[model samples]
Each structure stands twice: as C-alpha cells, then as structure tokens.
Target: MPQYSIKDHLYESQLFINRSIAAAIIVTLMLLLLGVRMVYLQVVSHEHYTTLSKDNRVKLQPLPPTRGLIYDRNGVILAQNLPAYSLEITPEKVESLEQTIEQLALILPISEEDRRRFKKLRRQRRPLRQYPDPSTPER
Candidate 1:
C-alpha cells in the first residue's frame, strides 16, 4: 500500500505549469498551421480559385436546334415538328426577373397560376418544348 501527502501544493502547481506549457505549445502549433494554410490559399492558390469562380459566374449553354418538319417523297411527313412559342431570358441579361415577370404579366395577360408555372419552369430552364395541338395549321 502506498500513501501520498494531501498537502502537496508545490507539486500540484508544478504539474499545472507543465500541463499549461504543453497546452500553450499545442495551441501555438495549431494557430501556426492555420495561418500557413490561410496564406497558401490566399496567395499561392488565389488565381486558380479566382478563375474557377469566374467560370462559374458565367456559364455557356447551347440553344437546341428547332425541329423542322421532315417530309417523304410521297408528300407524307415522316416526322412532324410540334408547334411551340419559346421565350428564353438569360438571368444575367435581366436585372430583376420578378420585375420582368410583372412587366410581361401586363402585356401577356398572365395570371398568378401562369406566374407560378413560369417561376417553376424558369428553374428548369428548358430551352424548347412541344405544345399540344390548338387548331394548328399544317406547314
């Protein structure tokens, strides 16, 4: 059986000081590592990240070709292109999409349902779509 003194204040303070010095060293190392990483990212890797951000800011999407009616030798349409009126607005071109929609509502007699559908479809950004037959004349 080993017995230790309860009144060892100097030993306790020495242990505390040792632990404190170790903790300080660890914290200082972590801070130095963090600072080095920050410097690398901000200085060395700055241009690479800047170009990536710029590329992301401006995206190029090709417009799909309009499907024209394909005819056979015997005056029969092998394939027919559906009639549709597509309106495309680049988000970057428009300052305010909501305001543009409001302006369009005045001209196009658009309702809340139409506005809601437009908003929903705008997120999709489908360039072209086929519309159902509504007394469409054959071309």
Candidate 2:
C-alpha cells in the first residue's frame, strides 16, 4: 500500500494572492517614477534647453580686413588699392542694350572707350557683365 500527504489548499491560495499584490505595487511605483522625471525635464529645465537651442541656431561670420599697399625694394609701387566706380548690366533685364546705353550716357558721362569695351564684353559673355568707368582719374 502507498501513503500520500494532504495538500494545504488555503495556505497556497493566500501565498498566490500576496505575490500578485507585490507585483502590482512594483509596477505602479515604476510608472510614477517615470511620470515625475518627464515633468521635471519639460518644466524645470525649459529655459536652459531653450538657450542652448538658440545658440545652436544662430551663427557668426567674420569679415575680412582691407588689404594694405605693397611696394618694391626700389620704393616703386608694386600694388596699391584704388577706389573705382563700375556699371553692371544684365542682358536679360534690358529690352535694348543700345537704347539703355544711350539713355545712361545722357544721365552720366560714358566715354567712347567705355562704350567700345561694353560692346566687346557683351559679345564674349552672357548674364551679368561688369565694367569699370574709366571717367574717374587714377589715384
């Protein structure tokens, strides 16, 4: 004959219930911690992050300084900066190049040499073309 011991049904049920309650409490605590961390980042640290973002978005560029004059050993001028005025014409914008030049000549002094150079450049290139007005005397 084989002998078997009786199982304690009430104790087993209480143990299972306790374990379920412990797991639920742990999960609830983890969710509460996550919510608090999210609130702190969005509200408390808002200004610091905003300033950092603005600093990243804006950029600063340095302008180059004007070049100085250069001279040879004999004191002869090798290179020097001269202020000169120039005229730029876009072929596409003007209805007639000859007419526009004639109109400009009436308003400003356009020499024969300037007119000749303008015609030569107009033939060689397209789009915006610039030429110096030699009417200004050399410095």
Candidate 3:
C-alpha cells in the first residue's frame, strides 16, 4: 500500500467533503422542487383535477320496480307476480363465451332458437322483464 504525505491526506479529505456537500445541496433542491409541485397540484389545480376524476366515473344504472296487482271484489289475483329465472353474464368476465355456451348447452336444455334469441337480445341494453300468465282467470 502507498502511504500519503500530510498535504495529500488533507487534499483527499477536502475533496471528500466537497463532493458530500454538493450531493446534499442537490438532494435539498430536488426535495424543494417536489414539494412545490405537490402543492401546485393539490391546491392550485385541485378543482379541475377533481372534475376530470368525476367524468371518468360517469355511470347509468336502470331501476325497474314491480307493478302492483289488480284484484276483483272476490279475493283473486287479477294480476299476479310470475316467477322468473334469469342467467346473467358480464362481457368483461366472459371470454370466448360461445365455447362456454356450447359447453353449457351440452349440460342444459338450450335449443338453437333459444340460443339465437339470446344472442339477438344480449346486444340490446334493455333490462330483463317477465310478465304474469295472461290466461290466469279472475275469481
């Protein structure tokens, strides 16, 4: 190992201190710039950013309530509720659903006409609806 004289040792220590001080100054400046930017975003432009966030979350959901029944003088259900069973699907959750539907058809009672009808109506945005049996006679 080579030994350094007193003057060389002093020069090395001064160089190390200068580099450390320069690094600390750069770090301090970066932190100050980051703080200023954060304040500008949170306070100066908060309303504009909040409105943009709201627009991204725009949504429309339909609510359909059940209708009241109609009855005659005799205690009879002129209009009654019909039990409806529905299978719901999400386009995002289902991938290659035709193959999945084929698998389901093998296990369930699904006709070609039924599949065709489902495919036609599935693209429409109408909410599912079920009506009471029309032939139900008044008592």
lDDT of each: 0.68, 0.74, 0.67
lDDT of 1 by residue, 52-90 (tens): 999998666666657778999999999885545434456
Give one digit per residue, the lDDT tens place, for model 2 in 1-139: 8999999999999999999999999999999999998888889999988999999966565544488789899988898876644455676667997788788888888788777766666677756654433233323
The candidate maximizing TM-score is 1
**Clash pairs detected, candidate 1:** none
Give candidate 3 regions above 4 Å deviation: 1-7, 59-139
TM-score of 3: 0.39
By lDDT, the candidates rank as 2, 1, 3
- Candidate 1 lDDT for residue 93: 62
| Model 3 clashing residue pairs (backbone) | none
* Model 2 C-alpha lDDT versus the unseen true structure: 0.74
- Model 2 weakest lDDT span, ten residues long: 130-139
- Candidate 1 TM-score, C-alpha based: 0.48
Write the candidate numbers in order of decreasing TM-score: 1, 2, 3
